[model samples]
Target: MQAKAYLQHPILGQRLRECTQIILNVDGRSAEEIFGYPDNLKFRSCLTLFMTATTDNKVFKDALLKYFDGKPDTVTFDILAHH
Candidate 1:
């Protein structure tokens, strides 16, 4: 499913797009491949799992911090921090 279907805000949608790209290109991780049957995912669970590593809680934050070059703005980081 397209991100716009789940993400209502344009800026958030853009950020999600970028995050997905970073995970895929920079991190060499496929979001859809990791997330089986992507269309069937529960929005909240999908988002939470995407933002938090199943292996370790700190991994997600570390990944996000690195993705943003270590100085991510509060609003964007806040959303990632929650999960």
Candidate 2:
């Protein structure tokens, strides 16, 4: 409901998208501990949700693409490497 309401205002939605940031913190925990075991839905759901969001959400995709003023790859690499 809130997401739908936000979508109603394109400018506001875009601004929100621009302000979003994601930290893929793999270093903080083991991969299995983070996503859960494959026998359960937690692992699949988390992966699927992320895949769908990144692939289907145009605004989110663009924001990620332009992360840190179009330095997503470099910045993300640095972060993951450091952390």
Candidate 3:
């Protein structure tokens, strides 16, 4: 299922909303501002895990590089920090 759909699943939706609220309370920014949106955060986190799990895969590396538009390291670091 797509990240948005998965996030909308009742249990997962509640968990994500709770987490997002906590994050906003501490950071004072909406999840959209910090992570694009809940779905974007889910997608980025999944992609990060995929990249890490397949570190030797050239295709994953290439895709991640393209995802970050040539700033993969910096963007990945920021994403990691945010999560």
**Judged by lDDT, which candidate is best?**
3
Over the full model, what C-alpha lDDT does candidate 1 score relative to the true structure?
0.44
Superposed by TM-score, candidate 3 places the C-alpha of residue 79 at a distance from the truth, in angstroms, of: 12
lDDT of 2 by residue, 1-83 (tens): 34445645779655644433232323354334544565223333323333233334554444333322322344334444565
Model 2: residues >4 Å from true position, as ranges? 21-83
Query: How much lDDT does each candidate structure score?
Result: 0.44, 0.40, 0.48
The digit string of per-residue lDDT tens for model 1 on 1-83 reads 23334454668645665655555354543333555464313322434444433332343445444433433345533655665
TM-score per model over all chains: 0.28, 0.26, 0.32
lDDT of each residue in 1-83, candidate 3, tens digit only: 24456455789655754553445354444334656756555544554544454333344344334444423444655755676
Candidate ranking (TM-score, best to worst)? 3, 1, 2
* Model 3 worst lDDT run, 10 consecutive residues: 63-72
